[model samples]
Target: MLTLSRRFAAVAFSALALVACGAAGDGAGTSGANPSEANADGELGHVLGQADAPLTIIEYASPTCPACKYFHDTVKPTIEEKYISTGKVKFVFREYPLNEIDVAAYAMARCAGDDKFFDVLDDLFENQEGIRYAAQNGVVKTTLGAIGQRHGIADTATFEACLSNSEIRQALADTYATSEKWGVEGTPTFIIDGVKHNFQGEYTTAEGFSKQIDAKLAELGAQ
Candidate 1:
């Protein structure tokens, strides 16, 4: 049995090459390859809304982070409805797993294929508490496998294969490196048009965050 830690240990703080910001995964099974794909910033990760939307918000988040969950469950939907749906913003979510368990959970999401990427992420965020419980009870993979099954991962056998997949592991490591290069210090960090935007203090609420984005759109002379 490959203990979860040893399974994903190759990518933890060991300095891996960046994946050149496109194709959610290089090759292998997870996310596969799509060379011509890219976002408004010409960087690649899972994206929502128009590809050329003027505002591109890159979010660095962890699976287990409660704040990350809040943003996903609450803040994101509001932003999506107001900005992303209107072609004013391009949203990119990059995995910034803070622990070995988070890495495993994220790897399973990637394994579900790019087409199902966001679905898996949504499910993981929705069931984050259950996942934490499973991890505590020594049934993390089984829990993750169940989640994967709902997102086209097939069965436990296939689930296990992708969970321990070398390519997915490497891609995540590359994401980790890329996050460092971009100076991401915490989960839920947002970068708009190549600049980090902190939504703390008075900017914490949905209405508050929207005001900041609204100001940015105004500055850019809204399309």
Candidate 2:
């Protein structure tokens, strides 16, 4: 079992590479309404809204994070309705797994592939409480296996294989490296147009987030 302290230590070291290499943009343009695109490797994370939306909001989150679940359940819908659907904001979800189980869940979610990624992600967040219970009771494998089946995975073997995939694990680690470079200290961190925004405990609601985003859009002269 991977402990959080050790994981964070790894992040601290990997972030040194980021400093040496310089801060790379999220494969999106810094000026104008440059559309977000999958990297050359075809990894775009899980994205929503148009690629060319004026504002791109990159979120670093873990499926098991309670704050992340609240954002998904309470805040995301409002943002989708007001910004994503309107082409004003493009959203990108990146994995910042906080524990072994979080890594497993993310791997399985990606194993489902891009078409079903967000759907599986939703299910995971929505059922987080049950998953936590299962983990505490030592049935995490069974719990996650059932969740995988519900999302079209064949069986426990397949789920285990997905969880053991080196490639997927590497990709997830790379995402964490990027997040570390960006100074993400916790889950539910947001980066708007390359500017890091720590959750200030003030805007956990849609209205609050909107106020900040709208202000940024106006500053950038984006409609």
Candidate number of the best lDDT:
2
Question: What's model 1's overall lDDT?
Answer: 0.70
- Report how far off residue 126 is in candidate 1 (Å): 0.8
TM of each candidate vs. truth: 0.80, 0.80
Q: Ten-residue segment with the worst summed lDDT in candidate 2?
A: 13-22
Reference-based lDDT, each prediction: 0.70, 0.72
How many Å off is the CA of 182 in candidate 2?
A: 1.0
Q: List the candidate 1 regions with Cα displacement exceeding 4 Å.
A: 5-42
RMSD values, in order shown: 9.4, 7.8
Model 2 reaches what TM-score against the true structure? Answer: 0.80
Error of 1 at 5 (Å): 6.2
